[model samples]
Target: MSASRPATTTAPARPAGPGGPGGRPGGGPPGMAAMAGPPQKALNFGPSAKRLLAQLRPERAAVALVFVLAVVSVGLNVVGPRLLGHGTDLIFQGVIGRQLPADVTKDQAVENLRADGQDTFADLVAGMNVVPGQGIDFGALQTVLLGVLALYVGASLFMWVQAYLLNTVVQRTVFRLRSDVEDKIHRLPLKYFDANARGDVLSRVTNDIDNVSQSLQQTMSQLLNSLLTVIGVLAMMVWISPLLALIALVTIPLSMLVTAVIAKRSQKQFVAQWAHTGALNGQIEEAYTGHALVKVFGRQREVEQSFGAKNDELYQASFGAQFVSGLIMPAMFFLGNLNYVAIAVVGGLRVASGSMSLGEVQAFVQYTRQFTQPLTQLASMANLLQSGVASAERVFELLDEPEQVPDAATPQTLDDQPRGRVEFEHVSFSYDPEQPLIEDLSLVAEPGRTVAIVGPTGAGKTTLVNLIMRFYELRGGRITIDGRDIAELSRDELRSSIGMVLQDTWLFGGTIRENLAYGDPTASEEQIRAAAEATYVDRFVHSLPDGYDTVIDEEGDNISAGEKQLLTIARAFLADPAILILDEATSSVDTRTEVLVQHAMAALRSDRTSFVIAHRLSTIRDADLILVMRDGAIVEQGTHTELLERRGAYFDLYNSQFAAPDVEEE
Candidate 1:
């Protein structure tokens, strides 16, 4: 599929070299098309916009209040220019009247003024002090100026109220929005997290919400004022002179056309930019996370070239969107100024012919400038709001994801107790349904028995344990804990009874004591120490400066892998689940540490049912029962001694690990 085609400002993809973008055979990155507009698209505000308004439903009252205030403020502001024009006209009348002959009768002056199309008597009073050379109304002009001052003060106050109310309302809305996103994250299933990148998800929660917050704060006030300004300015312009108003209105449609085309195109670029940015982050994350493997295989140069490709794509997309969107302001300004020049010329002609007063001409010119000011602002912010909407759509998309099914209406609970016995009956499952991985699989672990699962890679050893833990639901059968069906129990109740220590040990950022207590937070200090001692975690803790209080960094990277494994084992021991599964729990440790862990495992599993998925055959030699698996099903089952005597798949696997590669004669 062609990636993001730009709407208005299209840029061709960079020339492709070997292995094209991101070391893949494509003209550009897979999802990123060159920045171009779609051949066609309807100008509809989609569901994302509707959803945003719905989120703001609670603040409707405040928004309505802001609208009313905007009208009043704009009405007051609009009248000030006309009042200024009135004062200018009065001054012009006064100056012309002063130049009149002192000996001339007022009636003769009026007759001569009529010939010149001037208001003969409005700028003067026919009193004794109204001398031809002098009578000025300084005190009266000051009084009139105060009214304009009052209008401006009132408008400023009204705008202040609107800003205050709107800011509070916007923040409250974004707060709820952020809270909803956090809540949605928890409700999402493990499968969601597994499939989506953490960085992208975090971008929605952080970057997207910030965009919405900032845009809402700025756009709400700007939008309200712009709408009010445009309406009031249009009305005043038409009242002054409809012909001039019509001339000024020509810029409106032209400005809109430019804004719409550029907006549509920039919107596409914004979406493409974010997508390529995510791809770039993914590439960087993967390469950096696997830095050791890259160095081991000597693919650092290849990795750098691939990153360069992604970085270049990101740069092109970002530059295209920003450059195009940036044009809105200057484009609108040029158009607005062009309108100003046209109106000024036409108004000047009317004033010269005395069809319009000089004051009125100035007022019309001011109103024309006022009209375009709002259009320019609206045109500029349109792109910002569009970008915010794009971000919001991503967030809403996550919120709309299908969640895991709720537990049964009346869930069964273990009542703080459960037998270690587990049974899987005719269970069929697959990660991808079309590619069946497990078919009609069944296994039973009797109470206090240690069941060992041995298989080659892709043999579904981990899949079986996942089924038992109910991490993935069964497709065609029932898995039971003791005698009760696992589906009947709340997932929490069912999962709490089982403890897992996987090959990958996860330790959050906290102290060693805190991480160990994570499996069972209620564990007392004494109990915590016992579990740590049991798993030999205490010995390492004591060696550190802070003992059990030693802090672990992310994923416990501050500690050695062996120590992390030991901490996980201690945590599971502290949990003390009715059933335990140690899936390659001892794999990270050295031989000496392995002995310590194996000894702890034997003691911990003495009374509970346990399943051990192992690659090292020597460790599971004494398991009560051994299940040899191949191709997602059990191929053989017996005790270690019985399996060895049978000389089957288990025999070959056991010997393979201990067997040295044969030295062939040269």
Candidate 2:
């Protein structure tokens, strides 16, 4: 179910420059503490007024047509009432008030005219022997009635057309907006995803966009139609009787004030409701993704309790928002009823005193009702509009986020035959500057050699590889590929020269061949099989019911962990990069699978500079060089035998893993 939340804060005022708060150029607020708040105001949505104006894009053309049609429709409606009143006045003067011509009494003139017409008709119909004076003309009455019908028909047709056009525009515009929002989510930087929970992001893209779409599709056209109708009705009311028009308008300002107050409160509630929905979605996603772990740990009750809290929060928020927004309709209706009663009472007294005609009073009442009808609709739809605005603000917030590190303007391609030499000069890095993960350090890996990085968790082993691939930029220092600074090389070109296989294997939802082809999209079927065979994944894949055509489920859950690792190896094999980084690539496999993977690695390492982050020292025992790292710095580097002889961190790590367990004596 859809839910809403109160807005916690006003949207931020636009900054004069890209720099926010302090004077630092392009920097966010002064410190990390400032980041904790309601999501930053959408930098690109502009002021609230501007955002409202932007919403008009959907109905601009429709609005113009509505204006023209309303003017014409109102003119026609007014003309009919005025003509009917004139006809009534003429009848009263000629028949009831002795205001006819003085040539004869009213009855005598009517009799004489009827007799003359009957004789003339008898002369013309002599040959046919037709009867005379059988039917009355009543042409004036018929003409007025037909004219009124025509006017009503024209007004209704225009109204229908206007409604259709407005609604069509609203739906189309909203569809495009939703599509654009989804596209932007995919284009956002990886760091954004890291900072925000996946569930929250998904909620924004789906729930928030859906809310905006629904509001537009359901309420926007009604709003436009009502607004035009109200304007037209008010104009007719003034034309009918200025005094009654003034009485009807007296309640309008009061109604608007009441609506404004309610809208402000409802807008806040809607914002809160939306936020709670996001929180609830986040909780649900966490529960499902970790279902296996939660069940294994017997944390079902705890999970349920957490879910219940979030569910209750959402319920409260949604109910409150709806309840508050719902108030506008009744409030407006109350005022509209008051205005109607006032107009009816005053118009009745005027007509009774002969100050206004019966027809005029009738038309006046119709106009007053028309005026109230649109106002009522506007009050109701204002709630939807405010909710839509809140959703738009969230969506724009994502689109407006700064893309800080764009690819280079002019990128240099890597050499086709790269020497596989990598060097880091004075490199320092951090996820947050206050807590540096890696300090100023330098390292080198030569051509066609294996380099094993051994470090405790969080010692920056993975960070080093990430930097080499330019996934994250260094705060200080430069990294070079084949003697060329990596920053100058095209990002695509730099990455294409490197291959990585991590501990966690990610196979997308596709056939085995498709997953392998991801590494080299143009690779032939034979080449793909060769890569799979090299990694020993082909044996298991071929055993599957569909062989290579078998589809992998999300996270590769359909296959064993060992098989997923093998598939990843197959991908890397197909990539055939000049440089390879293996982060515990064989850690998940069994002894047999590890031996097979080791063989695959041996084949892949030829003429490639390989960096292996090893947990099991036995896997990298044959490396050409081993770098024992501690606290993000290399402590020792040499062949495995040389490091063992030195008896340093490497020797200690190797002994811990390969050391025989003590036997118990009975």
Candidate 3:
């Protein structure tokens, strides 16, 4: 009876909607949009990226500290080249000075050369800070070297600290994000799951979240370092020689142009890539979940073809995103090289003319390299940053899904002693507003009575049960228990008093005793065994090697269907609910097991309000009330003999099965 049925006719299908993947009914691709192929751009890159960044808001202080550390580290690193250049000047000046005559002062030698028509050489000598006959000063050189080492050490220490803090902030932020997503999932309505693929939702929860974590971890600190390094290096370059600094600056625009062009093209591809990943995951999940069905129907090839199509789409999207973003690094490298050559030629000429010292030129070259290197690094990281943001957008989309209606702010409670007298008055409902499933239906089940519902497949049998369970809201009218409107009571409190055994038995991977305890967590071993015995579960369970301790497999395939059904009934008994729902509970068991199950059912149903949905008429022959349903309406209601005497819908349905067999025997 819980078997998958189309939406009730009361809720008719809506007209084709405007949004969702493939314009699916209800909404698009569950909580996400569908992707057919690579798009030209992301749907909302700016807002999604902003939202992703917002995840760091709670860690703003830690992030700020990391930024400060990065700045200090870059500043210390920037001074290293200048200090080294000073040492080089000291060594060069000493070497040049040592070769000159010891008797002549430094200025006297330069003036003598100017007097001898060698002013060019004199000017070069004048620019040098050398003693007339001095050799290399090991003491000064040692001091400079030590200072450079200290700067590097300090920079390294700060960078290490920055990295530690950043990792902490990132992990904590992602941890909270993961927790929020998990909670939000539970809050989503059942219809959302029914409309969306499980694999797709799983990809968003698991894969996309992981990608966001990795992206932030890999890209955040490095991007900050590169940017700060660029700024610090540029300042040093300008201080040393503005002319050469200007040459390096030319590459900035080139780098920007390359990044903007390639990143713009690649962002869309990255979005497509992630979208395809979700789609592929969905197909794989569906394929594996129904592998046996596919094999039995001989449709393996079709499933394979579908998988191949989705896989190919993912590959294409990945290739396009990677190929486009990949161009950024190379282009930046080429432009950087060109800038390097220009600065080298110009600096060398300035040094020869004595307008700039040899050491100054050396420092400028170092600065040029530092400036270009970070630009290249930034270009290379564009792909990672884009990819991470793309994944974040997908996750954000899931978190943004509309949640189910909220519980009442002040919920009413059932009486301590529940009577289980359920009444449905003028109830109208539908899955879609355009269609009607149940309209103005009224029924009253007095306390402790068994009401049997018999109908064809689409007669809204399960729908009625779902209403009592409040799985969906009513369009009009209300359902009440003990005169208290169900809508006023909290869902948890309302369902706590009811027990249900569905046609499709569900058993988790656990010991038999543990599964039984699931019905009532506080149930003791003695109570558990009592329920098991009552449901006839104690019979087969003892035959197993471990008895109650025997573990059920993940799929619960270790036990027969009948055994599983009995376990569920035992679980229901353990719950000791005031009301019970059995949806074709005995349909799976053999006739002999059915007889045993009937005894258990009778015991379980004692002094409890019971709703039995059955296809086999004989199973409910002794039901207190037999309701014949047709097209979402109750056509007849009476005891077994009274319905037969009426010779109406119930009589015709009954004779259709039993009368045919009698006629054949005759």
Positional deviation of 130 in candidate 1, in angstroms? 12
lDDT of 2 at 264: 71
Tens digits of per-residue lDDT for model 1, 192-269: 655555556666788778888987888879988998899998999899899999999899899999998889778777
Which TM-score value belongs to model 2? 0.82
Evaluated with lDDT, which candidate comes out highest? 3
Candidate 3: which stretches are off by over 4 Å?
1-41, 112-121, 659-666
Error of 2 at 458 (Å): 1.2
What tens-digit string does per-residue lDDT give for candidate 3 at 1-666?
A: 111111222322322121211122233212333333334456476887788889999999999999999999999999999999999998888888887777898899999878999888787788888788889999999999999999999999999999999999999989999999999997886557666677878988999999999999999998999999998998888888888888889888878988998999998889999888987888888788678789999999999899999898889899999999999988988998898899889988887677888889888888888888888888998899899999998888789999876778898888786879888888887665655657777787878888899876666677677778776678899999988899988889998988988877889999999999999999999999999988889999999999999999756889998899888888988998888988888888888888878877876677888999888898898787888777667777878888899999989888877884645543
Compose the digit string of candidate 2's lDDT tens values, residues 430-531: 666555445566777878878888755545567678788876667888899888889888777998999988876778999999999999999999999999
Provide the global lDDT of candidate 1 against the true structure. 0.77
lDDT, residue 199, candidate 3? 80
Total residue pair clashes for candidate 2: 14
Q: What is model 3's C-alpha RMSD?
A: 4.9
The C-alpha TM-scores of every prediction are: 0.87, 0.82, 0.90
